[model samples]
Target chain A: MTLGRLNHVGVATPSIEKSIPIYRDLLGATKIHEAFDLPAQGVRVCFVDTPNSQIELIEPLGETSPILKFLEKNPLGGQHHVCFEVPDIHAAKAEMEAKGAKVLGEPRIGAHGTPVIFVHPKDMGGVLVELMEAPKREH
Target chain B: MTLGRLNHVGVATPSIEKSIPIYRDLLGATKIHEAFDLPAQGVRVCFVDTPNSQIELIEPLGETSPILKFLEKNPLGGQHHVCFEVPDIHAAKAEMEAKGAKVLGEPRIGAHGTPVIFVHPKDMGGVLVELMEAPKREH
Candidate 1:
């Protein structure tokens, strides 16, 4: 299974509003998409376009948000996960399991509307990794 | 200062040797570079090339390594910092300072042999960001 791409770096922030300027003003990112809430994922997300990949800014959406614990520890936000695109999600999952890497949960539709799954940090050398199914090209 | 690329995502690990297989076997990364020690920075480093960017795996090289405290906090290792390339390192440093972001230190030759500076995490919305000067083009 060849890794498709370094899709994006997930950053958990307390406030996407507070984070935008750093990417736009400081990093000179010209194409930052509007922030939106992903209720299913329990986070609000915005994509900051870079020449090659993107910076995914994620903010907690509800009190029970998954990232709340992370924010509680960090208090100021930080890198949460790094996503890599894969051609096939199920194959990737099977390979991971076969290799003794634990998948956090079944693949679900991610922020980009593509199937994605998270690998446990312990299995991923302490960094949470998200394997996202690559979007199909229009014929 | 337009961001040139999402140069690499830095992952702090206890051992780069242990980290290489996850990238090569699990992620199917074919271009795993040789791990080498950077004595000046007190870390051993390796590059896992993705199609668009790279994942920099860094391990503490000595007892005085800068990432020692981080490793102490996160025993399993974790995402450390994200590096972005800029056309001019000096201009990027000045702009960050003007925006009230504290530059970690004077721009110094970084892992890639280009001048780079780190912006304080507090100023970058709780994320540590490295600004690297784009490599000069060979004419």
Candidate 2:
């Protein structure tokens, strides 16, 4: 199998509240989700639905947040990572490791409520990539 | 209308030749376009077709290639910009400007052969956003 589809693009923002207006008013996005904190991930996130994908806006939750370093260099905010869907995250991780790509950690529940893993940017040509298991559809 | 769809993610690479194997053999991508130079934009580009979108691999075309600076900061390369499709480039430009987002330059032809413009990263929360007119689909 191959990459399933683009799930979302993670944008690291200093203030999700400040950024919400741009996506909502300027871009005319109507399907934006309410902001929620992912305590484990140490970031507050909300999804802005696009025609084919979502923009995941993230803000550091507290001190020692993983995204703090990213924000330190880019105080205003910046694109953090690009997330893609995979039919099976385990298989996707296996395949990537076989090609010498560094899988950050074991598959864990991600913002999408699906098993996900991050690949090191160095391995993916300087782009931090997130691979999530595609959500199953019920008939 | 809202952002039509994510068209492609532009990645700056030192060498497109070197990155192809990872996306193809590793990621199982099969529909990669041949690499070509776009002197006007000061870079070479190639598209790796994903299931729902594309990853545009771009390399500096010459000594004065604009991407050279990005490559310097990220010697191994990095995600440069994410492009989205719009129904009307002019309307999108107007909406962004009205919202106080700086749209760079006049709309011009982009790598997709459609009129496109870039929103300054400062205005876009540190992520350079490219808005391209949606390409016509062939029946």
Q: Tens digits of per-residue lDDT for model 2 on A1-139? A: 5756888889999999999987887777778999999888899999998888888999999897999999998898988998888899899889889878999989988998999999999888888999999899688
On the 0 to 100 scale, the lDDT of residue A134 in model 1 is 93
Q: Give stretches of model 2 more than 4 Å off.
A: none
DockQ of prediction 2: 0.71
Off by over 4 Å in 1: B137-139
Q: Once model 2 is optimally superposed onto the true structure by TM-score, how far is the C-alpha of residue B37 displaced, in angstroms?
A: 1.7
Candidate 1 chain A minimal-lDDT segment of 10 residues: A19-28
The residue pairs in collision within model 1 are: none
Q: Relative to the unseen true structure, what is the C-alpha lDDT of residue B15 in candidate 1, on a scale of 0 to 100? A: 90
Q: Return the interface RMSD of the candidates, in order shown, one decimal each.
A: 0.9, 1.4
The TM-score obtained by chain A of candidate 2 when compared with the true chain A? 0.96
lDDT of 2 by residue, B111-136 (tens): 88899999998888888999999999
